[model samples]
Target: MEELMRQQQLSNGQKSERQELTCSVLFTNPKFRADKSSTKDEINSIARMVSNAEDLELDRVFRKVSKNDVEETRSLNRSLFEFGHNFEDADGWLKLEQPCKDQLATVLRYMFESHLKTTVQIEINNMYFNCHFIVLQVYSRFFSELDMIPLLVTLPENAVSQKAFMLSYKWMLSDEPVLELAHLVEVYVAATYLRITSLEAHCWKYFDDEECYNEDTACALYVESKDNPAMDVVRNLMLTRIRKFLLTFVATKEFLDLPTSHLIYLLDSDEICVNTEIELFDGWVTIGTRGKRTFGV
Candidate 1:
């Protein structure tokens, strides 16, 4: 019945000429070629409409409507995706102090990725992050200082035990373009957290070759979940990403036995020299003996 309703709405939506007007400047498809000024005005109008709607759990409630009207659906998607980051200062990350920058790094590496799992894949490709890679570099700088899970300081309160994540939902003014990208960026980062965590939960112990092992025990029931086809596809994709991430740190044997954190520890034992990249990023620290009791301090 829900599918039928969506189809019915789409038919009516096609007949509505008003649906053709659009506010998207990034894509210039046949249906959305409104003039720049007109598009900006329309986006502003929508922003004002939603600015103080203040309905609790608004996105969930809105999803309940299940409209097939394409433009209405899309306009709402764009608005919800752009809500936060509006209040950030003109030079938000650029002008931040070192401590604040450090905090932001923790937020990105751990906090942000854990937040957006609902809408994003666990492993995101370079396609999207390219636009905002600058912020990511900043994230690498400040929070990247630890060899261990900086998770102690970075865990969102909600994530410690609850279903929620700590995310800044600060609403933005109507003008800046990055505001449009903020929520999407949040989604991307949150997905990264889930992907990394999945690796920790499922494959951290085996130091050999996880793929070779997964292949060896291909028929084992514990490795493969239930009989749903869609679920199987998803599981396969996730495993594929996990493999790639592991390859980066995983020596053929090292990857099969331990998780990423343990592996890093194994390689960065006390006698290790300070690599140039580490100094440049200032993301990693060593403690005890050579790395003895040393960190960004």
Candidate 2:
């Protein structure tokens, strides 16, 4: 019933082709998993991994495309899941599996549709797999597939919002050039975390003596560019909310890999200061905002 309401609200009145394409993405990637892990811990693990971050790497596949495909699609993004999707389970929320699958499909379609690029898809997949695996570890400690309210919020028709968030965050933990992707994940994480998990009593204080980078290092980041634009986006987008999260939960093994108490102290301690005359992450300012957002953080 709730799913139906979401689909109904999505009556954008676009052409039948666009509507069909969006619906088609969902059919293959159904909303619920009949055989979702039964155990509480297993379920949370599934939700956390499945709903970790945005798939920034996946977004890149669509950024550039063949001239012909570009003309045909009208939009550069073969955006499979940007439109609204609704999923709500009042009794007991189920996993938003299809939404994640749909976004993944969108990324795949964009990549393959674009010219034959090198196997960069592997990096995206690796990041996704690792993040899910790690979330599974943490989730296993708690519950199996958490009530997605604690995971990612499903839009009226949006499923990937949660999972894509996980995808984005995974890159933050990754080593740049992969680590560079953290900047993109930064905003998405803050926004999503703020939206979904209003954890008890969060604080935001500037790090007076934080361990930031030197001017030279910042310059090097902007100069260096691997085929990985995902990392580049994250490095480019900077904010305290996202930065602190990555610096705490991601940037360090001492953060996620270590005990939670230890990481809290690490985050709460004095900010690691750094010189930034170069402005590596703070390069170009596109829109009215300081930085843009991707699917992940």
TM-scores for candidates 1 onward, in order: 0.14, 0.16
Specify the highest-TM-score model's number: 2
- Backbone clash count, each prediction separately: 22, 48
Worst 10 residues of 1 by lDDT: 168-177
List candidate 2 segments past 4 Å from native.
1-166, 169-178, 181-297
lDDT of 2 by residue, 1-297 (tens): 999887766765456769788887754445446576233343344445555423423333234346677622223343434554434424446653545345785664454344234221112222322123222333232223444423222222122234444443343333331222333233333334324221101111111113333233332232332122433332332222233344232333222233233323323534433234123122211221223323211
TM-score of 1: 0.14
User: Candidate 1 lDDT, tens digit per residue, 176-228?
Assistant: 21222223223223323433332222232321335633432321321232232
lDDT of each: 0.34, 0.34
The clash number for model 2 is 48
List RMSD in Å for every model shown: 34.6, 38.9
